[model samples]
Target: MTPPTPAIVTQSAVRPLPRWALLLLCIAYVVPGFVGRDPWKSADVTAFGYMLELAQQRTPWLAPLLGGMAPETEGLLPYWLGAWAIQITPSWLLSPEMAVRVPFAALLVITLMATWYGVYYLARSPGAQPVAFAFGGEANPPDYARAIADGALLALIACLGLAQLSHEVTSYLVQLSCTALLFFAVAAMPHRTVAPAIALVVGMLGLTLAGAPALATLLGVGSVVLVVLAPGSSTDRRLPWTLALAAITVVAALVAWKLDLWRWRIVGANSGGKEWQSLARLLLWFGWPAWPLALWTLWRWRKQIFSRQGHRHLLLPLWFSAVSIAATLTTQPADRALLLGLPALAALAAFALPTLRRSVGALIDWFTLLFFTVSALAIWVIWIAMQTGVPAKPAANVAKLAPGFVPQFSALALVVALAATAGWCVLVWWRASRDRAPIWKSLVLPAGGAALGWVLLMTLWLPLLDYARSYGPQVRAVQAVLGADPGCVQTVGLSRAQVAALQYHGNLTLERAGLQDECNWLVADMESWPASERMVNAARWERMAVVPRPTDKNDHLLVFRRAAR
Candidate 1:
């Protein structure tokens, strides 16, 4: 008998995802949590407010220019999108919440699509496909596994960094999503054609629009190098030259627009030398829990780290991590740098997953279970303590304490804890069954855990932040005293946080007080209280209220108002 010919795989024979299904999956993966809470105090809302004002023609395009902050700092694209959203949405539908969030929501969806495409292309690259096929085996082709892996990556991106940044309405998410697309195009480019050049242009536009001209220039240079150095025909040689010139021109234009020649003054200068070490610690904190696994993977894969095939896929993540860390170390506020590393880490995590599945798979599952269980317990305990008014750190030798002092916890806490524990158990059992399999076992626990964590944060963590955002009931109490009198409320010696909270949540327009008639209410910190009261030429106002400072200092909110007429 003649040997059967190997099945000829045609394009139609390969199952491709339906367009509608893909669109729905993208949406499902990328939608931000609609908790309707503003937790960053005012940064996000204030930026949106300015954008809204500009849209309403109350401000000029040069409004941001007044401060010399580029419209591109947060990227011009999202702002333009937000501006259009405000202009088109009916006034009744245009609440501060809706105005800021809608554009981000749309971008969030785009981010998911970008991530999926990036990972798919990266996996389907010539270097990657054989390994994927070998890992999957003929009995089960790797296509479905590849899709699932990409989906998991997309899901993780949406759940963790992307979700938080987009919902919080920061510029980081926009930049991150753009960077992902850039990497996708770079990885997927076929040598000896205009395809790589097109990808480079798209990436360059994305970076320019996302507000990082300097970094974008670097990426453009890298792209040229990648194309020129790729093993291919002589025709491919000319492509890089053309791409480099185009990228350079775009970079120059963006630089000019951002006024790169100007020397920007540093605000809130930190002269202390402790910042360098603090930044390192902060990086660890931000990377938290995820970095350990990433480090472990790197050590395990040290041999493959610099291999020819691995190098292409590895370059982007490595560069991303290095640049972000360097930036954080050099910057005044290190927290902002945390956002830069998230995408790199997420990508690294995705690449690391298969390896994890092959080795110590059971251990990872068990550890994850333990982590969730401990996390749930800790959250519940904290919730209970907060509800019962039990001091987190009680004073020694204190006397009077209340009766029936049992701590109370929210039902949500118990539900989350149980769910986490159950999920962990399920994951552990599933992994155990497939311990010997070469196939990629579905590891949904990490993604599920992240999702659950986000829910907890939105519902529980945000409400706690409300205390800080509400100006410690200062705004509410002031309103009670003033009762809608125009110019009746003013703040004295307020911190930026206090002023911001007043502006965003209280719906008040505030300016510094020069004279008593400037406004009625005055808020002051302890040190500045005397100066503020003196500046306003007021003896004292009604003692409206007092609240503890939201942070870890023995601070109090002493709300004094000018006597009501």
Candidate 2:
């Protein structure tokens, strides 16, 4: 038997958030990082490298390679999407770097939309609805569901980990978006059929193509089990849906097998004390604010969660979140694996709103207000230090961290940052002065504060971040040593990101170390200098210069010019 739900919400507390404000908040969150940033270090640039290779017609469509090294991730759809975006966009209108980001940005937007709808459907479940009052003042189901959905979205945006990874053009973001779609399909299955069925197929197939066939299969099978075990699921009503889901799951598995995309990458959990502590830290901060609320939801919904009534509104998200958390423990890149669980976590967090006491909500509001205000002030101070050197220590820290960086001021960026600051102030005022009756009021400061910090960093600290995180400055230093039109440069032991940086920023043609008969210059990683000597005739090549990446002194390159015979 199902226990009484803990929620006792009223009609007044379910007031809808304005549609315009929600749209504007989403736009503010989605647009900034995609627009004015370089393809950053490691994964971001490496993925962009593969996409650039495909766009330049230098790599096969089925298999992309950079400097003869294939991408480490087992997915090709992300690269295809980026390459397609680059190919279709005219260069005069948008550079390939900017064009590649457009689709990933859309994927993030879709993830947000799918998450909202998924939470709405879950909140509409009979078991999740608020209690009826003797006076008939209980919150209407639709209004309450919408209010819950609004809170879920705000929680997702406020997760600290989501800001950076979601903005990158990587397979992980694709997987995350597809996971949200699958989650929506499963949650909406009982009430709808056609659209949910279509979403299920697309979601499953998308997961297969996006390098997470295992996750797709697990989630699909789990949904089937939940449906069969659900109360009042007459065999007649359940069998057809079960069979259809099973068929789609089988087809998805077959597609993955045919494409040879299956990879067993489980790296098991690390038992080392420090590694465990690091992971613990990651979990704590990465899901901040949301994690605490999710825990609160579980506590309040404990009886419903464990009851025989099969309260799927809680069960489904718990399953999804559990699967992702399990993967995070066993995976190599733990953070990306954990990212797939966030939408479900946020959904779980939303359910806590109906049960939270006034004191608890006030505590959340006060903590968020204090935390983000200090963060914003710190960013502003650093920016001021970089511009005018008003505070000596922050400027000194910047110079020490990113050596040889020349700071430049942009009036446009400053105006945007100031405008965002003003908007944040207005939002704080609204939250502080207005009635706190709305269920989502508690999350307003957290979401707005998160957006404010992101905007400030993207506008105020963009140049500094680019200089520290990007390969542009390093590439330019190499070009300075090579002079104009250094043709057909041979490379040895260069990383995929370095090769891509050279091609994009230096515009230099590259050949393998032993393969370039006509090349006059060679660039080799300092660590691979021995291999360079073995590959080339040492007498014919003379050392030119050793160029170090400004941010990392240990990471330097050896430049060589072919000696005149």
The CA lDDT of each predicted structure is: 0.51, 0.90
Query: How large an RMSD does model 2 have?
Result: 1.6
Candidate 1 per-residue lDDT, tens place, 113-176, comes to 5555555555443333323233333322346335434533533443344445556565665666
Query: Which residue pairs does candidate 1 place in steric collision?
Result: 490-521, 492-523, 541-561
Instruction: Report the lDDT of model 2 for residue 231.
Output: 65
Error of 2 at 324 (Å): 1.0
| Stretches > 4 Å off in candidate 2 | 232-237, 532-534, 537-539
Number of backbone clashes in candidate 1: 3
